[model samples]
Target chain A: MDYALNDFLMFTPEVYLRLFERTHLALEPWFWAVPVAWLVMALLLWRAPPRARRLVPVAMAAGWGLTAAIFMLQFYAPINWPVGPFAWLFALEALLLVLLALRVPPVGIGPVVLICWVAVLLALSLMTALEAGTWQALALPGVTPDMTAVTTAVLLMAWPRRWRWGLLMIPLLWCGFSVLVLWALKLWWPLIVPAAGVLIILIATFWPTSESPDNA
Target chain B: MRLPIRRRHFLLGLAATGVAVRWPRTLAGQHESPITRAIPSTGERLPVIGMGTWRTFNVGNDPVLLDERARVLELFFHSGGRLVDASPMYGSAESVVGELVERLDRSDDLFAATKVWTRDERDTRAAVAESEALWGVGRFDLMQVHNLLGWEGHLETLQAMKAEGRLRYIGVTTSHGRRHEELERIMTREPLDFVQLTYNIADREAEARLLPLAREKGIAVIANRPFQGGRLFDRVRSQPLPGWAGDAGVSGWADFFLRFIVSHPAMTCAIPATTQLAHMRENMDALYGQLPDETQRQRMINDFQEI
Candidate 1:
């Protein structure tokens, strides 16, 4: 069907941004633990790559589940009918992450790269939260879909497994979807999501997989 | 030939029914009743200022937003507004309007209008049934073929439903200045009570053909996107109204833009959608006092162009 970008989005930017605040309030107090857990996991991944390999994906899986339940189902689905399928897509990504956790080999990712990834993800989350005009509406990794997808894509780039492309599919699709929605709403800051995804893909494709010690 | 007799009877019936309400004076301080136009076919008078549920009323199931929107609706009805337009394509808007109308207990005054928007020809009846269920109105005052999607099948079914007393009126709609030729064709060939298209001071393409055709065909023209999807407000945010605007019953930009459309000789109503109660009040305010005549409408066009 021939449709304009405006046709796909039925809510205004004000209503769209308010979703974050409402979601945060709906899951209050307990919501604080989500970012804390994500921070601890990132610290472990940066400092101790070997031990954190299996744990990181599992934590990310849980984040995907939470995003599906809290954000997609509870908040977004009402405003956008397609969000119901998006919630299921999130659940599928969660399942894929769990599978990755089970099968992932112990790979060594350098501390510098890991820390940079952590900082980037953290900055993106804070930027999104601040745009909503409140810290409580923080779009934390492993809690919200955009940050969680970007974090997963970047993390998978560190691993040189050929099958990692399979895990990257949903995250990439979601990033593209987010870009369209944000662009339609005239929200420029959140465009960093798909930009980061593209940058990571380029880096992962060009970087010498054989020479990198992380491949071991 | 029969139009004058029908119009006379319609006016007499309106007097007998006493359905019209006395609207307050315009912001320009003019003493005039709220502007209402009679349906060409039935001569039922509808207030010219209608509400639209496009991007504004799709608040989902949020209680806070629902209440906020209820207040907007309360102000609309209080200001003598009616003829609320919605469609199945607008997410949760139909349900939200249904809920608010039920809560406010103003269904009797509401000229409930919604659309059938499905690609499947067989789904036309089902879509209307679903809208009826969501709106809790038993039957819609007007059922339109949204964007003319599957209009051929939907219009046929809608005509049957009207005959069966399940629908009061049937029409087709298009927006953003799309498919006017097809819209004109439908108006010429079919017995439509209404035809909604994009019409505003900024977008006047409909004036060349659709509006004139509607006038000739005796079809009520519902002006959609009267504010150009709220872009007109953004454009004139820093600009001031013309000094002589009050003479045309324009107190603000909302009135300036809306009165231009609803003032057109062919227009039956203009539906301006807004989420804010203040905006709803401003939109409803356009209903009062004198509307711009052709010369003033031309001046409005010139003024907006300079902005």
Candidate 2:
């Protein structure tokens, strides 16, 4: 049990990064639909009615499902054994998202918070592409785990305190796991993942309920 | 470690006078008989160069990488390698090796060796069965207790398997210079056929005790991390090889580093892992040509220290 972090990581940074490019290649032509899903989610979150806004979590659930199936199970599990259990965790998160969508009331998130979340998404996508040294390897929200976790955490912050804490479990777990993996790979730029997770937890806990209708 | 004045003067004289020693060159498609060493327990001989599947062979299910790694194995066999060592701890490497070995049809030539690495004693037989299913080979030539985890129970099962004619060899392994005292105690108490630990020019701690113990106990020694997980190359990347290195058939750093390890009397073979065909070729080249004698090994140690 006294194993080093590098002992669990069998592949090199080069091989790990190439996984994104290989994933992109595997989903070619139909890959265009991924960005389209992102745009639709953004538009629905920004302008839709309160009842329609419930679709946001439903959409996020789809993102989690895709990431678990395509990225974690297909591309990563082959190289890293622990990723197999991680894929099941993601699938469980997707099921939880569906439950949240059905049971929880939709909270009205402000335009400012929505815009900041979108900015965070775009910045993460660009940073991932730069790290991979290719635009084609961009880790978009629905197609990759890191961005999907970040987006899900931010969206879950709009819920009431009890629901928020329960729903944030998987995304937080994933963010912490991602931080260790990136740190072990010696890549500094991708630490943005856990940072964003911390920011979401802070905003969800400390932001004044009187100032924002979403916290009500 | 002081050198004899005459031998020192001869080496310095070669350096000072710039005497060019002809290094043996083995080109691709040219076959030279590889050097072999006898297993201590049984006189069955294995080539000095064996293949290791650590980070290199864990390429997963990618067709392109599978084919590429298959070609690397192909080159290894073409260069006269037989023993291939793997473990269940290395993700997907066992399955990948099994698939590639079947594809190349080299199972007959392969001296397949793998390890049982789990904390549960009851799971040892199941783990070996899974490995056999993955490797597609009916029986493994060797099965080791990786890192000495659950060693007592696993070793008992392995002893039974050997007695049942289900396995040819049983041994224990540790790497990165960890747990040497425990390994030493096991070597003394257990009836092991082989004892693998880290041995290289950089990490010579094994030479002090475990290696000498292995020699005395008539146990075969497999040297893992012969290049110190590829860190030794980084140290000598910018430095030039000694002028007299070619006199011992040292053409490149791989040969220089590897020859120094396998040249030891106690070492049965050194398993070096590589992904590229060119690097595999360089590693296998160490199997051919003359190895450094006792004086030359010290000279190699001296040269390495200066770097």
Candidate 3:
């Protein structure tokens, strides 16, 4: 028999499962704290003044930084060697979030898109929690590529259109890559759930908008 | 050829009539010679058992893990192993092999087999260069097109390289016995020195056509996934070794599975991957003792099926 494309992959689905289970198992005590932080950010986005709400990205930045340093670099990178460079990219994404949060320009998306994106993130968290069989599994949500992609989608909604693509670049790319990895590992349900969210954000962002006169 | 035969017969005369001296006293201080087979293309002899580096040797840049993997290679060589098969797709296995061999300074008897994995000519050329650099070797003994990704194009380059004295042999590899028809087509036309494919007690489909074809075409066969990626062990882990296995001189299930594989007259070698030292020894031990003849092999297969 000739070799199949899957034969070229370095790892099997078992390897990925082991890595994820290890990472989640290692983050036991910190799991509850993740949801608390997210709850606070959600409240600020819903109830705070426009200027105060600008600081929501501050929480996003902090979450991403912690995900990069504590979750990815410390926990995941050692087992999966290729993830080392990706950990640094997560750090860079954290920095970018911090810059966007501080700049706080006139940035807002339609309420409908915001609600839909938030629903996607919550569904992702629920699915992960159900799979892991614990709410504590939510602690390092940003560490998971799907959660990170969700965060990027929400952040893009608040950022101006011109800046959206640049900020969306890394997480979007990660979503695509994770889809392949998940597919190889045969984690069909988890991958399909997040893939749907990613598709929605991609369609919304790239969908042609009616300009001052619909030039095209 | 005639002189080597006389020398081989002289060595065999000193041992059992059918047995060859596998490890000379100066080499490994052993009594019974491990079984050896001829590569159909070149008539060069290699041990019937070899080491495979897939997930086992891909401990990328971790010094401690690299040292541990090095120990595995050391044990392989010390146990009279010659062929170490790996591929670029195995993460950092090629580099790990290079590091261990360079450190042990045991490249002389090592039969290094690696693969070219890309499709584009420029990428394939660069990939070969990178593999050579990672292996820290001047020449590869066998270079196979990995999974036939760009087999035709890479075959041309491999042929050219072989002509230029850059490589000793060219071949192709596959796993899980996925693409038999396409591989059979290529095998019929290509002047391949080797063909690597998955074959284990559980996955004996290769015995139907591929093995016989290799025997006919004079292409050496390298049996991979000999333990069915650890599934065979899981199946037999709790079961007692068949009573007759001891009489056949197979010590453990590993040896039983491996012996069953290499016992085929057409089979060249069985390359099994393992990281643990004890497992490596178990795998190497399969090279020793009496290989079951055709009837015994059929009985062994039927017995395994009953399990």
Q: Please name the candidate that would achieve the greatest TM-score relative to the true structure.
A: 1
lDDT string, candidate 2, A156-203, tens digits: 766666777766777778888888888777767666766676567667
| Candidate 1 per-residue C-alpha lDDT over B82-189 given as tens digits, one digit per residue, 9 for 90 to 100 | 899999989899998998887777798899999999999779889999999999999999999999999999999999999999999989999989899999999999
Best by lDDT: 2
In terms of TM-score, how similar is model 2 to the real structure?
A: 0.89
Per-residue C-alpha lDDT of model 3 across residues A54-73, encoded as one tens digit per residue = 66777777777777776567
Arrange candidates, best lDDT first: 2, 1, 3
Task: Give the lDDT of residue B25 in candidate 2.
Answer: 42
Point out where model 3 deviates above 4 Å. A1-9, A12-59, A62-216, B1-29, B122-124
Q: On a 0 to 100 scale, what is the lDDT of residue A137 in model 3?
A: 47
Off by over 4 Å in 1: A1-4, A46-52, A205-216, B1-32
Task: Count clashes in each candidate, considering only residues at least 3 apart in sequence or on different chains.
Answer: 0, 0, 1
Q: Across residues B1-307, which tens digit of lDDT does each residue of candidate 2 receive?
A: 2122232343355357553143124433255668999999999999999999988888877776776677678767756889999999888899989988887778888999999999998788898999999999889999999989999999999999999999999999999899999999999999999888888998899989998899999999999989887779999998989989976568799999999999999999999998877688789889888889999999999999999
C-alpha lDDT of residue A97 in model 1 = 83
* lDDT, each prediction: 0.81, 0.82, 0.73
**How much lDDT does candidate 2 score?**
0.82
lDDT for model 1, on a 0 to 1 scale? 0.81
> Per-residue alpha-carbon lDDT of model 1 for A1-216, expressed as tens digits?
135686568887777777777777877878788878876765666556564657878888898998899888988888888778989999998998888777764365666876777788778887666676778667777667788778777767655557477777788778778888888888777667666766665565555542344434
* Runs of candidate 2 exceeding 4 Å displacement: A1-4, A105-116, A187-216, B1-31
